[model samples]
Target chain A: MNQNYSTVAQRSSSVLATNKVLRNTYLLLSLTLLFSGLTAGLSMFLNMPPMTYLISVISGMVIAMFVLPRFANSTAGIGIVFLITGLLGFGLGPMLTMYASLPNGGNIITLSLGGTGVIFMGLSAYALATRKDFSFLGGFLMVGFLLVLIAALANIFLQIPAMSLAISSVVILIMSGFILYDTSRIIHGGETNYVLATIGLYMTIFNIFISLLQILGIMGNDD
Target chain B: MDWMQIASALALGMFLIILFPAALQMMKNSPKAAPSDWKAVIVPMIIIVLFIMLLIKLV
Candidate 1:
C-alpha cells in the first residue's frame, strides 16, 4: 500500500513538472516572437538596407550556437535569445521591403504569414496531443539541416533561380518537421529548458515563414 | 522543364525519398503515449491543407 502511494505521488509530481515546462516554454515563445516582430517593424520603419547575408548568417550562428548554449542557464540567456531574434528580425527588413515593392507583394506576404501560422499551429498541436517522442528525429534532422545549409550556401554563389526555389521548398518541409520534433521534445520532457525550446520553436517558425515568402516571390515572377 | 528545373526537382525528390522512410521508421519504433482522439490530429491536418491551398491561390 505504501509503495502504491509513493508511486502515485511520484507520477503526479512528474506530470506537474512537465506542465510547468510547457507553460513556461509557450509563454516565452510568445514574448520572443512579439519582440522579434517589433524589431522587424522598426527595421522596416527605418528603411534599413538589408545586412549582407554572410555577415548576418555568421553572426546569427555565433549567437545561437555559442552564446545561447553558454548562457542558457542564467538570466543572461533571455537577453541573448532576444538579441539573436532581434538581429534576425532586423536583417529581414530589407527583404520585406523588396517584396513589398513588388506587385501583389502584400498578398504574397499575407499568404505566407497565414500559411506559416497554420503549419506551426497544426504540427505543434499534433505533437502535443499525441505526446509522441520525436527524439528519434534528432539525427535525421541534423543531417538534413546540414545538407540544406550546404545547398543554400552553394545556391548563393550559383545564383540559380530554380535551385533557390527548390531550396526554399525543401527548407519549408524541414522547418515544419522541426516544429513537430521540437514541440514533441518539449512535451515528452526531452527538453527541459523552456528558453532554449522557445528559441528552437521561434527559429523554426521564422524559417518556414521566410521560405514560403521566397517561394511565392519566385512563382510570382514566373507568372 | 528546363535543365535547372529538372535538376531542382530531382534534388528535392531525392531528399524526400530518403527522409520519408527514416521518419516512418522512427515513428514506428518510438514508444507512444496513450492514444488521443483521432479528431485532434485530423482537424489540424485539414486546416493545414486548406491553408496551403489558399497560399497557392494567392500565388
Candidate 2:
C-alpha cells in the first residue's frame, strides 16, 4: 500500500512538472514572437537587406533544429527554444517588410492573427471535448503535408497563383490536424517531455500562421 | 535562391526529419515503447538523402 502511494505521488509530481513546462514554453513563445516582430519591424523601418538577413538566420535555425532535439536534456532545451524562436523571427522578416510597408499591411497582419486564433481554439476545443484518440492523425497529416510540398514546389515553376492559394489552404488544414494530435498527446499523457511538446506545437502554429498570412494577402482587398 | 524559396525548403526539411522517425515508431504496436531501435535509423537517413536531393533540384 505504501509503495502504491509513493508511485502515485511520483506520477502526480511528473504531471505537475509537465504542466509547468507547458506554461513556460507558452510564455517564452509569446515573448519570442514579440522580439521577432520588433526585429523585423526595425529592419523594415531601416530598409535593411531582408533577404540576406533571413537567409543567415534560417541557416542557423536549420542547424539548430537538427542538432538541438538530440540534446534536449536540460538547459539544452531552453537554449533550443530561444534558437528556434529567433529563427522564426528571421523568417518573418521578408513578409514583415512587404506587409508593413503596404497601405493595407495592418489588415493582413490582423487577419492572419485572427485565423491562427480560430484554428487554435477550434482544434483545441475539439480535442478536449471528444476525448477520442487523435494519434491516427499524425499519419494523415504527414501524407497531406507531402502533397502540399509537391504542389508548392510545382507552383514555383508553374507560376500559378491559384495553385499557391490551394496549397496554402491545404497546409493550414494539415497544421490544424497536427495541433489536435499534439494537444491530445499532452492531455492523454502520451508526451511527457514538455520541450518536445512545445516544439511540436510551435511548428504547427508557425505553419498555420504563415499559410494564413499568404491566403489573406492573396484574397484580401488592399484598398 | 530567394528568401521565400529558402524558407519553404527549410520547412520541408524539418517536416521530413520529424515525420520519418515518428512514423516509423508509430508503425510498431508497442504502446509505450518507441518502435524503432538503431536499426530503424537507416530508413530515415535514406529518406533525408532523397529529400536533400529533391531540395537541391528545386534550388
Candidate 3:
C-alpha cells in the first residue's frame, strides 16, 4: 500500500513537471514569435533593404550556436532567443516585400502562411496527444538538415531554379520532422530546458514557413 | 573569384564543416530511446505531403 502510494505520487509529480515545461515553452515560444513578427513588421514599414545572405547566415550562426547555448540556463537566454528571432524576422522583411510585389503575391503569401500554420498545428498536436518518444529521429533529422544546408549553399552558386525548388521541398520535410522530434523530446522529459526547446521549435517553424513561401512563389510564377 | 563570392563560399564551407561534427556529437548524446509509435512519424509525413500537394494545387 505504501509502495503504491509513493508510485502514484512520483508519477503525478513527474507529469506535473512535464506539464510545467510544456506550458512555459509554449508561453515563451508565443512571445518570441510575436516579437519576431513585430520586428519584421517594423523592418517592412521602414522599407529596409534585403538582408544579404552572408550577413544573415553569419549573424544567425553566431547567435544560435555560440551565444544561445552559453546563456540557455539563465534568464538572459530568453533575451538572446529574442535577438536571434528578431534578426531573422527582420531579414524576412525584404523577402515578404518581394513576394508582395508579385501579381498574385498577396494570395501566395496568405496561402503559404495558412499552410504553415496548419502543418505546425497538426504535427505538434499529434506529438502532444500521443506522447510519443521520437528521439530516434534525432539522428535522421540531423543528417537531413546537413544535406539540406549543403544543397541550399550549392544552389546559391548554381542559380538553378529547379534545384531551388528541390531544396525547398527537402527543407519542408526536414522542418516537419524537427517539429515532431523537438516537441516529443519535451513531452518525454528528454529535454528539460524550455528555452532551448523553444528555440528548436521556433527554428523549425521558421524554416517551414520559408520553404512553403518559396514553393508557393514558384508555383505562382508557373501559372 | 570576386570578394563577395569568396566570402560566401568561405562562410558556407565553414558553417557546413562546423555543423557536421556538431550534429554527430548531438546524436551521440541524445537519449537512446525507441519511438513509442511509428504511426506518429508516418502520419505527420503523410500530412506534410498532402499539404504540399494542396499548396501546389493552390497556385
By lDDT, the best candidate is: 3
Question: Weakest 10 consecutive residues, lDDT, candidate 1 chain A?
Answer: A49-58
The residue ranges of model 1 lying beyond 4 angstroms of the native Cα positions read A52-54, B1-53
User: Which of the two, 1 or 2, has more DockQ?
Assistant: 1
lDDT of 3 by residue, A91-147 (tens): 788788889999989988889888988988888898898877788888778988888
TM-score winner between candidates 1 and 3: 3
- Cα displacement (Å) at residue A60, model 1: 2.3
Query: Using TM-score as the measure, which candidate wins?
Result: 3
- How well is each residue in A1-223 modelled by candidate 2, as lDDT tens digits? 9999999999998778757765665676666567656665665666666564556455645655677678677777767776776666665777767766666668777767665766676666666676556665565566667767667756755778889878877786677777777877876678767667777777777777777777667666435
- Ranking, DockQ, top scorer first: 3, 1, 2
Docking class of 1: incorrect
What are the fnat scores of the candidates, in the order listed?
Answer: 0.14, 0.03, 0.52
DockQ of each: 0.12, 0.06, 0.53
| Residue B3 shift from truth in candidate 3, angstroms | 5.7
